[model samples]
Target chain A: MQRALTLAALALAIAFPMAAVPLDLDFYIGFASRVMIYAIAATSLNLILGYGGMVSFGHAAFFGTGAYVVAIAMTHGIDSLWVSWPLAMLVSGIVALGIGAISLRTRGVYFIMITLAFAQMMFFVFIGLKAYGGEEGLNMPHRSVIGLGLNLKNDATFYYVVLTVLVATLYLLRRLIDARFGRVVEAIRENEARMETIGFSTYRYKLTCFVIAGMVCGLAGALIANQTRYVNPNLMHWIVSGDMMIMIILGGLGYRFGGVLGAIVMLVLDEAISPYTTYSKIVIGFVLLAVVLFAPRGLAGLFDRKRVRAGGGHG
Target chain B: MNSATRMTEPVLEVRALCKRFGGLVATDQVSLDVRPGEVHALIGPNGAGKTTLVHQLSGTLPPDSGSILFRGDDVTHLAANARVLRGLVRSYQITSIFRQHSVLDNVALAVQARSGSSFRFWRPVRDESALFDEARAVLARVGLADRADVLAANLAHGEQRQLEVGLAVATRPAMLLLDEPMAGMGPEESERLIPLIDGLRKDVSILLIEHDMDAVFRLADRISVLVSGRVIATGTPDDIRANADVKRAYLGDELEAASGGEA
Candidate 1:
């Protein structure tokens, strides 16, 4: 049943852009692409926060860094997708290495606070970059050129790109969580002392996982920059980090693909409620409260009742 | 024991280890040794600093002033995991298996750690049949083979203790630091653990801190009685039983009860 649901979801994702045109709901193509991009970001956060048990509250630093890489490259007349995308991922991974090395030394609330502080520092740095439109943000005149007659400016084509990346990210994370490295991280999450006694340097594993997650989120940030054609300091805001965290919790903290489900639900709700009232956040907040109180395992838990009952529900 | 054999180098040596928390000295100049292939039990009264001493030996607690030598190497300053990698592994008094994972997975992780390639990121861990086989052998050794699929949290208290031993054994340690291996066991469970632990002496030396006097007396090749953060006696079981200082400090009543139970 679970496999069927996943397959159905995948089919829907692939078919949505094509279906949107004839259905006269073409705007949904770009909207769904945005959801997929956020899903990529949320999924990356889940790698560290859910699987590794590193509650990094400064993920936006990587996201904004990736976006800025694209924006800055565009400002310099470098429109190649291949160059900017890899550079974005590499730069964000390096940033994550520096931040994670220091932040992983502290644990629990201190770790959370430290990551947030680092992200805020990045936000301020970006805001102070006067050449890149400063606080107002930078605008890209055109989407990144792949140089193979492939146009990312087209909504349906771009939607396919985002969808492909999301699928690949999910696939990579699945392989990762089932790997030896994944087992060690999960073991560390369960019992760090025991993991150490059994011969694992948990700090090293966590730092590496942090860097991997940051690079993945950085890729998402690059995609978002192209989709929106804008990069801003607000992309690295603490509230954005909080939103990604909320998506993880709402989708299912440890469950693979929960982030995608969460991003879709959250983005859809945001779009739906915005037309009704400017206080859409109020509605979204109440819905989140309901989900937290009733489905502590997140929306994915609603599908796997047996797992929750068996006490093996963690993703 | 032959004099030459008795003088053989110790596998673990703790010399004048001391730890103080503010004004209180938790481990006050404690010294002990475990010769190769011998179960050297560290017995003490409550607050006798046995756990503190264990903490120092296991590298969890830094000593104010002391040194620990393992297999003729000074390892006092090494971190816990580094010590573990050097073939010194310890189990907790409270069972510390990976609670959310299956019993097999708990042991498998230990085996994986020792397998020298846990850094492999792309390969699925489940496909590693060698790790599973090794883990199964360890579980069978500890008599937990049947419970391998059960979650650690779902295991009986006795089974968790067995799993704890299995986890340590999976690491293939040269020396085992067992902290209360039978802390909450019934006579039946304790009976099962005795032979299981005694069986390990041919391969690994053990520095055991157990409150169960009967098991300690039965299993220990040499027993050290610790009272108020000091070793009052270190000798054979019969010698420790006859020591006046040991009787006065602690184990006075328990020794009598243990001897009576034995008879």
Candidate 2:
């Protein structure tokens, strides 16, 4: 039954933008695109936070770095999606490697603090660099050129691109979660000392997982930059990192669709409620509190029919 | 005891292992050896540093001064995982099985460690039938095949203990540092573990630190009594039972009880 529902959801997602272009509801296409981008970002956070048990509070460092890489690449005559997107991911992965190497040495709260410190350091570094518009940020010359004959400047076309990327990201994440790498990662999360005793070099696995998450998140950043046509230091702020973490927890940690569900719920709630009240954040806060109190497993747990085993993350 | 087996080199050799915390010396010049296929039991009272010695041997704790030779190679400075890769494994005194994984998965992960690099990111682990097959065989050896699918957290205390050993056994280690495998087990649980441990003697050497005197007397080929971070006696079960120093240190009351139960 859940499988059928998921298929219906996928069908709706695919058909919605097509129907929107005809009905002249093109504005929602861009909004839906934003949701997909955030979904990717949140899913990357989930990879480390939920599955690996690494509470990284500096995801925005990679995301913002990716955005900057794309924007800067455009200035240097590398505007093609193929080159810039992968470059963004590469740069973000390098950043995660540097940050994770240091951060992973410390665990629990220290890990959280160290990651945040690095991100804040990145934020400040960007803010100080006047060449890239500094504190005010830089605007993209235009949306990244796909060079694939698709008009990316159009909202509907861009929405389809983001949708495809989101689908691919989810598929990749699913493959990873089912793979031997995922098994080792989740087992390490469950018990690192035991994993070591059983002959696993846990630090290497965790660092690799962190790098992968960063690369995926970087892709989201590149897409978001194209969507907004701007890059700012605020993109790497600690608040954005907190926002990603909130989405993961609010959606459901360790569940397959938690990140996507969280991104959708959070963004939709913000969009739907903010117009009605200036104090929309207070309402959101209350809702989050209610979820934490009543739905300890987050929003995705509500849809699950099986009582997930006590220690096992969803497959 | 055959002269050929006695003349064979010890699988693990520890030389003057010492550790200090502030003013207290947790491990005081502790020296021991495990023959290639004998259960060498270490019995000690509370704070006797048996666990500390095991921790040092397993590479979990660094000794202030010591040398550990595994298969004649000095492994004192090797990391814990590296030591396990060299076939030196240890089980915890506390039950430390992965609580969220199934019994089979817990063992499968151990089997996965020695099979190959776990960096295979594309193929699903479910497709790796060899890992599960070996893990099932390990579970059966530990008498947990019936509970293969059960979550480890849901297992009874004794079953969890069994899984703990199962995990170590899966690594196919040449020597096992069992840090009180029967720490919290009931008499029946300890009884089941005795033959299981005895059965393992054919494959690996064991350095067992156990509080259960009955299990130790039944399983140990040689017994070392530790008191105040020092070896008070090292002898055969019969020799240890007759040793006055062993009784004076840690085994006085338990020695009587063990002998009575034996009779």
Candidate 3:
């Protein structure tokens, strides 16, 4: 039953842009693309925080790093999507490697604090870069050229692109979590001492998961930069990391596509509620409270009953 | 048969190991050895530093001044996982199986660790039938084959203890550091564990730290009595039973009762 629901959801997602085009709601296409991008970021965060049990609070650093990679490359007249996207992922992955290496040495709240500190350090560095608009942020001239007559500037095309990437990321992560490496990470989360005694170098495995999540989030960042045509230090803020964390909690931690579901719910709620009042955040805060108070497992938990059973044994 | 004949190269050797936490001496100049294929039991009262000594041997705790040799190699500085890779594994006194995973998954992970690089990100773990086959064999060995599909958290206390040993044994360790494998088990459960543990010595040496003196005496080829962070006696089961110093320092009437029950 749940598998059929997931397939139906995927079908609806793929047909969303087409349905929007016929309805003449072109602006919603861009909005949906933004949702897809955030979904990718949130999903990546879930890999470490939910699965690996490494609650990183500096994920926005990787996201912002990816955005800045694109912005900086554009400033240098290198506007190819292929070059900039891979470069963004590579830079974010390297930063994650350095940060994870240091942060993973400490655990629990200490790990969270260290990752936050590293991200704030990156934020301050971007703020101090006088050449890149500093605090105000930089603007992109246009979206990257994909070649082969594909125009990313077209909203419909861009939505499809974002959807493709989101679908691919979800599919890959699904396969990854069931793989041997994924099992090891989950085992480490369940019992680090037991994992070590069973011959797993958990530190190495955790660092690897951290790096992969960072790189995937970086891809989201690059897409966001293209969507907004802007890069700023605000993207690397600690609150942005908290927001992604909230999305995971709001959707359901450790659920395969919970991140996507969470991003959609959060973004749609923001879009709907923000027009009526300036206190959208306050309203959202209450919703989060309700979710936590009643459905402790998040929105995805309502759909999949097995999660409640699995979640019961968590230490 | 004789002391000299049994004195071949020991599989594990701890030389004058000492550890101090503030003013408390947890392990005080403890020295011991486990010969190949023998169940060398370390028996002690509560807070006797048996767990501390086991931690040091398993590479979890670093001793202040001592060395641990495994198969004649100095492994005092090796990390816990590295020591495990070298075929030295330990089980927890508290049951520590992966609670969320099925019994098969818990054992399969151990087999996966010994198989190859777990860095393979794409292939599904279920596709590897060899690991499941070996994991099933390990579960069967521990008499948990029937419960292989059950979540580890749902198992009874005795079953969980058995699964814990299954996890440790799946790694194919040359020496097993079992920390109270019979802890919290009823008499019947302990009875079941006795033969399971006794059968393990044919494949690997066991360094057992147990409070259950009956199980220790039944399984131990050599017994070491620890009192207040020190080894008070080391001998055969009969020698330990006859040793006055052991009785005076720690064993007391329990040894007499156990020996009488055995006779």
Model 3 chain B: worst 10 consecutive residues (lDDT sum): B1-10
- Residue A113, candidate 2: Cα error in Å is 0.5
The 10-residue segment with the lowest total lDDT in model 1 chain A: A306-315
Cα TM-score of candidate 3: 0.97
lDDT of 3 by residue, B38-125 (tens): 9999998889998988899999998899899998889999999999999999999988889989999999999999899999989999
Best by DockQ: 3
Q: Order the numbered candidates by lDDT, best leading.
A: 3, 2, 1
Docking class of 3: medium
TM-score for candidate 2, residues paired by index: 0.97
- Model 2, residue B196: displacement in angstroms? 0.4
Model 2, span A187-226: residue lDDT tens: 9888899999999999999999999999999999999999
lDDT of 1 by residue, B80-193 (tens): 888989999999897887889899999999999879777788899888999999999999999998998888888899999999999999999999999999989998999999
TM-score of chain B of 3: 0.94
Model 1: pairs clashing at backbone N, Cα or C within 3 Å: A254-A315
